[model samples]
Target chain A: MLSSNPIKKSLNWLGRQLFNQENPAAFFDPLVTPINPLWIRGFTPAQVQDIITETADTKTFVLKPSNRWSGFEAGQHVNLSVDIDGVRYTRTFSLSSTPARWAEDGTITLTIKRLPGGLVTNWMHDNLKAGTVLGLSKAFGDFLVPTSVEPLLFIAGGSGITPILSLLETLEKDHYRAPVALLYFVRTQADVIGAERLYALRQRWPAFNLQVVHSQEDSKPVYLGEQHLDTIPGIKARLCYLCGPKGLMDLASDLLGKYGISDDRIRVTFFSAPAPVFTGESGGLVTFSRSGKEVEADDGKALLELAETAKLNPKYGCRMGICHQCKCTKTSGTVVNSLTGKVSSPGEEQIQLCISVPQGPVTIEL
Target chain B: MIKLTNEQLDALAKDLDAIRDEALADLGERDAKYIRKILRLHRTLEVGGRVMMPFGFIPPVFVAAVASLGLAKILENMEIGHNVMHGQYDWMNDPALNSQTYEWDTVCTSDSWRRTHNYEHHTYTNIIGKDRDYGYAVLRLSDDQKWHPAHSLQFINYILLTVFFQWGVGLHELETEKLRSREIRLRDKLPLIKEFFQKGGRQAFKDYVFFPLLTLPVAPIVLLGNAGANLIRNLWASTVIFCGHFTEQAETFTEEECEGESKGHWYLRQISGSSNFTGGLWVHILSGHLSHQIEHHVFPDIPAHRYREMAPKVQAICEKYGITYNTGSFGRQYMTVLRKIAHYSLPDRVRLKLQAA
Candidate 1:
């Protein structure tokens, strides 16, 4: 609607001409940014209003996004970016608070758990405070509650309980009378995030069944099995939503398939990109997604050279990797960074084409 | 001409590489804060100037408006635009400061700049017929270029070039000389020509049309102020850049001699091809730290602000290798540049032996 409006369109064109920028806000952002970091354009800026320690390694960050931010659905995820040691790093996290909460108080929460070597999550835990501002992308994820008020089953592990908490809160607010069961998995009771809120919801909502399953009870870990699936009421009829580590998700999908639940009925969400195992070999069928061209790369040359050799003139500068002018999206396959010698995960990632050498077959959006 | 042996060149390379690494390692909060402060200052001046434009009927106010706008343009073009486009602060990961996508307030598109200045120029720095930036394919700086009767007025041409420096830089990628020689077809250059017009047209509209028209009865004064501001920025930017590389002591290299060059030899070439000038903090900032052009040539991707700390170490390495570290006061260096332009304007047969700079 805004795009079709003639006055707004002409104003946008005039702004572009006058400012020599993408928009007027960008041209003026630097002037007012020091007064309030939220004055920034392009990305939505959010201020940390509060922080709650959920576990030893996990914390819930309560953020108040600027009014320009379009709110999200209850069970969606957003990418949070933080500046660490002057370099910006980003990581994805599920919104732990419901949309109604944001509408009422202009605030949302993201529950994060620290990864062993994770740069962003660790920085958030150690450095982020009540007044720190961070960059946020709009919420995105298909892990949403079904509108049909049918029996629903939720399976969450570790920090994966985040989106599920938002879904549960929304369901209760809407007073949905349909049956619901949540099998929340954690290593131990101390590690259970939002423990009090889960128990509170179980007591207040009659149809909500909350099961806190401790996998590592008394140091003898008991994993998910058929007994857990068989005990859930109406397992065949209820639609399933899963969020967890890859191992748990695969196991759950396998058990649900065996129980006659179709693949379409079982939806799952992965919190982070799965790390790829490298064979330490060279040569891959490099696909340029845009051009639909395939190149058989044999030697251990950077992708930029290979692209140019195939007569594809991808934008590049400082061919040795210093200038990020050559950075492009590698949609799939692992690559080793020549400068830092770090292996990349086999998923979509921004990489400097001048430094990235494919470990095997890799696809890039040139 | 450089006389360093292979062993000496290797040691020089090691020393320069160590200096670059040390500066890069020290880049963190301090570097980020410094750049952000400059960005804020630039924005403040620009906003203040625009706000004052409507009241330009007053003589003092008009002068202040022009000066404010000029300083802002200089800061943006040199300190922020030039250095950021060099990929100096790519580690910051700020979208506005990103080298790949940042569009400066100038007429030249960032894409064209990245190709011409970053890739072609910086990579092949000062190698005749390779780095077009040697004299921007215009004035003949070194004797390597063939002398022509047209070069007789290159002294006057240099003055005109400085006054309209931004336009000259914006049109540098068109390879106008190649176009004249019919080496590149006009049909092939249609897309580039369109890009230049679009970018340059927007800049003209902004400074010449939009802002002036918005000021109603004070339109003429506002227009004059904007033109004056652009002139100041162009002259300042041109002078600072000329001092960086055009000093008499700077050497020119042959592309054939650079074939299969080792890392040490590459380092030697960079030092020989560039010159530096001494200045205080404000001068350094106004020049975008390009006054330390020798250190910048060694590590172009490193943050420009760090060049001050890196210069002494680079000079020490040059001294150790018996290399001439070309540096002098700003006035002295700029004088040598003017002398070189005048001296080179004549045929080599009639040229006088100027004292070593």
Candidate 2:
């Protein structure tokens, strides 16, 4: 038994070569496709094991991915592809489950907050269910906890508690020696996500502290301010982690700066891009030259969104302005970049379809 | 068809563009589902057909197996592979469905086809000297083409082309005409020739060697069945493609005529240069949705399944603009194409006006 088993290894290789000739990932398909075997190939497929309602507008999706899924880091994000009405939509979400949990149960969780009038999120909330198959990209992003054992402060707002939850659970499981405090803000008490888990963590870890702020319940909105920072002892020395809406994160950053908390000590993750300003003149025809298709442009919407509405599938990676994957040639007319608030000169120029809204009649070489 | 002024033609182009936009906007789950289902069915049929080929000891089994395999190849080459490789489903963001990355199960490399068909044929359409696909360098499709002594043998050439259509498509990018004229140096042709051989060798090995050899004692039967299947697929593909592009009603434009072409002129050229055939869903799929050739010429990147829904809308726009939408039954279209090919083989003056009428 102690000797190297050459025969076993050879047989394993032979078996793999014979069965996995067409697809290397076919073995994993059987594992996850017990309920639905008709999974899309050439993509990492995962089955929705369960859906847990975290709040009124938020739900945590538990996924059991194929064996091809390499384990993800605690604070990493993964791109998920879901098909709604036969059209596939991709969105990135931070994995909220600990690596230990994934190792033990082979499951991960993504807490999604439904955005009103949003395409993917609304479709997911309304239609996604147990046994539904989804495509997943390998884990990415570098928002991990530092090696230092300095006391930690985690500030989470609304649905921003996802990655923080992962970090806390990992720390608690590892028996972290440092003191940790969490300030979770939501509109009301009912809006709190993972309340029971946070309570359990507080009971188990002696140095762990939890503060659930119900902002809407009070006569005046209870925004995190200097007063909140003063309550946490030695807050200036703590390694601060912030994940929240842009407005809340901005306020916290200002306060933390005033408190003399160093820049390196603060880590922030944005769940979504800030809402784009819709100042471009619309109600003009947007023509796709190659497809010979034209649609009336609605005021203040990015060309990518308009393309989607027109049922012309334009390639895009990150919906935010950062990714240049959605760049297209504007053959004529001006387009305003919603992210930078810069207007393009009329005539031929490359514009990011995801960020550029039509100023007037536009023709795009899509 | 009523003659129209330049301004009226421009209005027609605008109306046709509007139709395309409306068609795109109307695309929904049904359109996506159609292609997805066809892909699955094609795959299933291919597997089933291949599996049944070894049992060709039974005469009925041999015919059924060959027919099934032939149909599978047709569907794959036309409905699934060709459409997918056109960047039709690129918006789906499924890497498997991406046009740039899709490799079809044919001798022709996807890269070469994309350049030859997607860029050259589609961009130039039926322009006499510009579009290689007008006669595929072997036939005199229009009177605009200089009549040659070699074109007298076009009747036989057309038959041979149909028999080996896939190989013709495979070697299309080689531009053998240029090679004959020494327009391309041998060094320039090296990479393309290497790619062609690589793809051709792989296809031959699979169809003629690997699968046939796997059948052992029934190897001959399997090999013959495979050959028969390929022949059927080739003939059908040739018929569908030829009918779409070379019918009597289809016109060829000169480079001078197409120069300084506005959007309206482009639309006019596409309408006159392409012919459509009326068919059911199965027929449409078998034709690779080339039945709606006019719509396809206008919108090459849109999913081919949407062409059926778009055809009537485009026709209505054409009617409003007094532009002729050249469409007919499958038999009518094929006969017309064959008649045109025969009629155009002779010198222009010698051709009968009665036949032209």
Candidate 3:
């Protein structure tokens, strides 16, 4: 029976107030001790439970998030906010663990591939360890399996297999009785992330086919060509999900198009953009009006990255321009939208700082 | 004195921007340590004050306890609460210091304060019809504000506002002006009114009823002590806040002047509309670093201690631009603010004539 007694409710409120349970961490955080994860609210606090080295430059961080974190879908992404040297940085990554794992163990995994000179990724790989606490935004993303039971083809390269691994695990848990094949491309056998798990899945499920393509092992530069599509039965009928480096994904897309597959049958998630080319007009001055801070901003980097480099902590959510938390006033000068390749006029306007690059001398109210 | 051209203004803005950027870059262990230390001191003072309150049989002890408690409340509201709510220490990633989540030890709710203070006041500082903080919908502070007969007794209104400043802040989110003009329906204000009463009730209960009831043998002394402490805190907050933005040199703007405003112009307004007071480290913290009002206005999200460091740089830019940097000792600034409030109480034509005289 529901307790609708006013006396009980009043006592509960009194208890919360007395204990500061609404935000218990605020009372204890002044001691500089580790905050109990259960007390964290608003931004879900997660403790690093373990770090599994997947490859030489790749790691899967197992996180135990507080109760405030709602479970995520099998193929969704979450924004991880970490503080390094007193500066907080937020980066979005796919949750590589299945929802079932989260339900059973109350934990999630983020498989991160360290890029050369990458700030957050390198910091996590080197500095993050068990017992370190970080902030996490609730899971959000549209990339997921269709409701219809169509035959699946997942083409992944490098670290792009993280989300697919989650989908495969979910499929296995559900006992999905559909033909599914994964074409995972890596530099060599040692570079294959989650190879053992894929092999085990292939042995357990008859309909599941795992292909680990070693690009460097083949002298002729192994690439996804039309010849690879012929190997898959009913290639045109399969729903192809592509996630990888631009080169491999583009090749696979072209091959899929020639096979007369409908555009609706193809789904692609871009892990990273190719390195931006710096032209003569790339470098410019960015003025943060409020802070009285200005920096010489070079092209090829987003304004959010520049702001971080300048040590101006701006609020951000999904760094991919989906969450508009980093939107600030662009008071003067022009900036190019990195996502849309559009130039903003010099005037007062709101621009998403995450995806904006200064075209010339720019002034923003950060 | 020379008038600044748009180009000159932009340059001044850039110079000021450089200082802020440098300070932000310089923020590290020391700045974090400073805030944490202040927080610890505030907590210690509060606990000490509360514990000593029941021993009011001794007059000196009672006075000291009240003073300690008042100072603690002042520090919590100004240096810690206000600045943290401004996202000054958000980089620390400490939930306690988060601008979006930190609830102050005042009657006002943090969410309401964020909307009214952080968003409205910071965005539209000293703009006549825009910034509700222009006399906080009570007394007139500028000639742009049309005078009403009720303002004739603005001296009394000012005193009332000071005494009940926390309650006034609690009710600020309701935007009583909009309700008065019928721009906001009574129904729309219901939720805010409810929130105000709930928060106000909790505060009143804690200070007047709960704590006093606990000290049943000396309930009257406890109640009076709490009231006295609250009164002291409110008065100090009101004075510090008023001196910052309602001084003789603080300028108010029109909506037209603010239209399509550039970053440089925004900075210009913030500096011109904020007055500062000369003070030591303790005085600055007690004032919630509002003694560096110009710097605080310019970089609302920068930690308060950084404002003290940035003040001279900011003042130099003001001097270079031939702009008046309104600053004086606390007594002088507070008196000037009161005089300005009184000057605006009369009709605009009368005030203009007085100004000319």
Candidate 4:
């Protein structure tokens, strides 16, 4: 505590020297301070969990503690939160495995079926080995299953079977045994998920009818592969839920709208995102239908660029499959097979033209 | 991918050659007027018969006059003369004219300049990716463009100049780039010093460099005259370009929009995007009539001279399709663009809120 002025001065000089050495010109900006982590509102898979495969490409990931006790009434969904790289991201999956699973094991099960580039599903495939601890949020979504006793019709395309499967499970468990019709579309015999479980479900319940529409080169006429939906009978009284891509949903909308059904009665879940963009070789011409202009797009290019060349204001958003905001209706003609020689057939109704190419000529309702 | 069809290719080649021939014809006419004058001066300067003068005024007198007129005034006069000329290819149509190679070495024409000047330079002004006109972002020669590393200091210089001289910075920067262009050489350059009655920069450089340098002299008299001419011209032009682009009307391309291959949307974007300054002929020509930015962006191959004729056609097309055509008088749109620039360049949150509607 005595006066050691020179020593103190020497220490101060050293401190200044150190500071200057660390920062030249004292111009270093540490940038704004990062905010605290957001306790995310999306759903999470239970940490003490296991994915028991109910069928091929289908598994029930049991989340412990049921995240939320009662926000969902059956058809609602919980957005699964996952840490993608360093950034936390979330994806919504319908609660298809039923709330009853929570009674036995304090777990809410998500019957996830694999789809292309599905972030959470792909992440689960890669990292979710058994007994891995994870975080989850309580259920948070507004889509609720109807409690009405009307004939419930579910028209599912490919992996669109998830929510319907959950609804059926809930109906059977709750003793709501209402008459139901399901027309499930699959690419091949191998594409059907939860088929065995569904087969048992049909055998136990006489009121449930199941139709499998397959897309294959050779199939029986009575089998009626991927034929028109208008041929399906007794749709007048059924309360319908359509789930698939925008094209599939449009078909559902148009066909069902014909029967004088109000749009509110039909709940549609277009596949999580839009379809894959048609990739191609370099340099093909793009003819803007109404603009009287032709612009060039090279291979692996999106058709939206052609509008830029012609000076058109096309409405848009994330061109990636995420937003699905740029979905345009393809009026007629085929889009060039960006990869193989097959055009994107989104049903007979529409195509997300952003992901489609020009074949011969094409017109769009821009 | 952008290859021309065989017939179009042949037409393009022939057109290129014809343009060359036309430029030569114009040069031939200029040589006829200036060739004898140069010869007479050379002869007079050599021996005592007559006092030979290569230029109308001595180098010092010319410099003094230019200094009084100032760099801004000289630029204004040049800009006016250039505007009046307006890609003048009258010489090409003239039967009496010969090509520059055969006829003259002194004079140049607008048609020839179009290849080097308009086609290559102006068409690519300040484009960041392919074109090299990456001028400073601050006191811009063009509009808000992608920043260039080389221009950082130059932009600082521009602002400092402006702080003292108002638009002195802009005029100097533009004229300097214009004068020192590659088109000048020693043969054309050496005589300018004698014209200005000074000796450092030869005439072609003087025309290219020193003639423009006349705009930047330090003297008060020179600076004053330069101010009057440039302020008017700069205001006229800056108003035109800034209004056409900087307005609330114009929008930046999203990554989706930028990369989309759809020509219709691009057309719609340009149609909906750019603002047009409407009305008047004198202001139009002086401002380079760029309010038709949408048309120019859509069909860059078309000449500026043809734009006036094409404006209505373009407008009609937009109208038929129910496309919104944005047009406003000079002052109205110019302030709009200024406000837009200020608004957009703010923090992202502010810009996002403003743009969401």
Most lDDT-accurate candidate: 1
Better of 3 and 4 by lDDT: 3
Candidate 1, residue B121: how far the Cα is off, in Å: 1.4
Q: Write the per-residue lDDT of candidate 4 for residues A153-272, one digit (tens) a residue.
A: 787876677777777877776666667778887777787777876788888877788887775525642222235455446677777888755656777777778877788889876455
Q: Candidate 3's residue-wise lDDT over A187-267, tens digit each?
A: 998898877778888888888988888888967778887667788888889999998888898888888999999788899
Interface DockQ of candidate 1: 0.56
Chain B alone, TM-score, model 4: 0.45
Docking class of 2: acceptable
Candidate 3, superposed: residue stretches over 4 Å from native: A1-39, A66-77, A85-87, A97-108, A116-118, A137-154, A166-181, A196-209, A232-242, A246-366, B1-11, B24-72, B84-158, B169-225, B245-273, B318-357
Please tell me which model should have the higher DockQ, number 2 or number 4: 2
TM-score, structure 3 vs. true? 0.68
Give the whole-model CA lDDT for all candidates, comma-separated: 0.85, 0.80, 0.81, 0.47
Candidate 1 residue runs with Cα over 4 Å from true position: A1-4, A273-299, A306-312, A322-324, A329-351, A358-365, B353-357
Model 1: what TM-score?
A: 0.94
lDDT of 2 at B252: 84
- Write one digit per residue (lDDT tens) for candidate 2, span B144-227: 778887887799999999999989899988888888999987788788899889778767776788788988899999999989
Per-residue CA lDDT of model 3 for B15-51, tens digit only, reads 8778876876677778778887888788678777888
Residue B6, candidate 2: alpha-carbon lDDT: 88
lDDT of 2 at B204: 77
Instruction: Give the TM-score of chain A in candidate 4.
Output: 0.57
Predicted candidate 1 versus true structure: per-residue lDDT over B158-205, tens digit per residue: 988889888999888899889999999889878878999999999998
Per prediction, the TM-score for chain B is 0.97, 0.96, 0.97, 0.45
